[model samples]
Target: MAAWNLYRHRNSDGSSKDWAVRSNSDGSITTRRGKTADSLPGVSNRYGVKQFDIERQKQAKGYVLVGEVDIDVNGNVVFPGKTSATPTQLPEPDANPMSVPAPPVEALYWTVDCHAKQTIRVELGIEVRRLIGVIQSVSDQQSKPEQDWDGWQQFIDATLNAETFELSGQIKSVHGVLPWLFLLALKAKSFKGVEIDIATETARDLSVDLKAEQDVLVFFGTDLDSIRDTAEVLGLLKPRLNLAATMSDTDDCWF
Candidate 1:
């Protein structure tokens, strides 16, 4: 019963917050939340399906599963690589302390499940593959495109063609495509960083700034309601969209 699921949300300003959840011996779930390094107090208790629902809610809000720790019966949190005897409280900083360094950003894997009967999954796969193809074409003119071309090709061959595929890299490395995809689903302003003029059929520089993380899973199901649920959790799709709308009327792209 010592297991805990730790989650962290990195802010745009380089700060981060933490959330932790663990199941108690009585089959109830407890959760904690606070800024990184703060001793967060247990904030809530949940049971059964509600526990999972809460977890998904946190994920949708951009909290990524960073790591896990152990909480002893005495309410002591035991972090990995630390001695059990160590005090949980961190020591105070000096009066004239230097700026604390930000933690190293870890590369995250983006996974999309394409093994479904719905055509939306296949459409999503095709869209992603098309983007990769464009990347390949652009890189072909560069001095060192062969390596990158081969790598992206492997991604398509390994995962997109099969049931599930995972793409691993920093968010910036993918040219911020995750957020762009989310924005496209919204259909409010832009597509692929371009402002669309429906009347003119032209594109311009996008005005909105989209944000997303590398660690997430995207799955397209049989209906918009299910897809919207998953997207809302990932913070890709907003809640204002009519859940009753079908895929035919909306943009199709996952992750």
Candidate 2:
């Protein structure tokens, strides 16, 4: 909140210059003693959070778009405003040609990361699948026809081959224990892919709901000492259990 090394260069005529710079406590440089600060307005870091709210921003900042699909002619599947589809069947020298309109279809795969220790709520949009079809004309110069089944098959192939997505968020809390443990659980789990759903419905506008369910463990402790003690006992017991050797003693085993 302090300004540093403010200066005004004076000419021999004793006129003052109009610029200044300031150093911020967070190791960030900022302009202070100049018209820039006054003209720009809202130049204070006072509204910023004291620490990073990892959970609050996790879902808000992360999303992965997997792939794109193209729409074919049953009609033009124009995004907003576009014209109608053209005829696919070609004209003949001796007979009339049949025409059909083509429609557009596509789906995009996405991964959303929710950043929060407390639960978050959100509204998700609809999910769609792409239709696959090839372009081929009876003659090389004619318009091509498409089939519904083929298009569906193409969508399947594209979605299946879509790349895997991983999303992470930084959350800040006075106590870092819960956050650290949650991260460790993610590392221990093995999943081909995961679907996460977290929500926070109340305080709609003021609070950003950032919550997600994952394949890994999610533990938040009001009582960390108890859980830590239990983990130590279990850790010691696991390696000592070898039941197969005890049961298979061939020398003189009588059970």
Candidate 3:
């Protein structure tokens, strides 16, 4: 590993001073500015040089953090950290060019609205029309004490006119045991691969086990890749289609 030592003048202010990396072999600085190598060697180009500045720095060489990085090696290009391999010689291309695999295409992600198509009707006592075990948000999260089943009917009248549905993770003020049973009725009707009998609302949480079914795909909110994969498998999106689209989409909002 060839190296250089930069320096600034012995008598100078810290800011405006000459600096250069002295070739380790020649003892002469390889880089120079205005007044030549006057020895202002505070910071070094590589990480090791910075350490040298801190421990055994000479007054002639002070250090400064600069915009550019300097790698003193010569000839074939050398990557940082790894010192052995030279990038100039690449692995020989496959004799049959067609044998080489193509770069994978981008993935496409699409939001599914199957729940929106499904709705609830109170005409037959708040029965679900489509998917039997679908969870629906009550118009009010907290069922009022004074508000009885009659009030629930009134709530049904005022809200739920639109086809809006609920995501699995929302809970309002406080829900009582009876409301839980109301929601769990769907689970009773839809014992599709569901084995546990949900006697209470708390049981509803564990009644549906996605892992028990071999053909079901369940993704946690954090599992963005699996969700995208499930969407693709269901024909909701094409293979390798990423909604982020741009290479610069660094946000974890999708996750």
Model 1 spans > 4 angstroms off: 48-50, 72-76, 84-255
Q: List TM-score per model, in order.
A: 0.32, 0.17, 0.19
Model 3: weakest 10-residue lDDT segment is: 105-114
Model 1: lDDT equals 0.44
Local accuracy of candidate 1 as per-residue lDDT tens digits, 1-255: 367777778789977767888767786678877676634555766543234444544664567775677655444556676644232243222436578653442222222222343354455556546555554454455344112222344445643543433221212223323333333333342223222111000111222222222222221112344334434433445667555576645555544
Flag the better candidate by lDDT, 2 or 3.
3
**CA lDDT of every candidate:** 0.44, 0.25, 0.29
lDDT at position 117, candidate 2 = 22
Ranking by TM-score: 1, 3, 2
Model 2 scores worst on lDDT over the 10 consecutive residues at: 123-132
Q: Count backbone overlaps in model 2.
A: 23
Which has the higher lDDT value, candidate number 1 or candidate number 2? Answer: 1
User: Which scores better on lDDT, 1 or 3?
Assistant: 1
* Candidate 3 wrongly placed segments (more than 4 Å): 1-159, 162-164, 168-174, 191-204, 208-255
Q: What is the lDDT of residue 223 in candidate 3?
A: 31
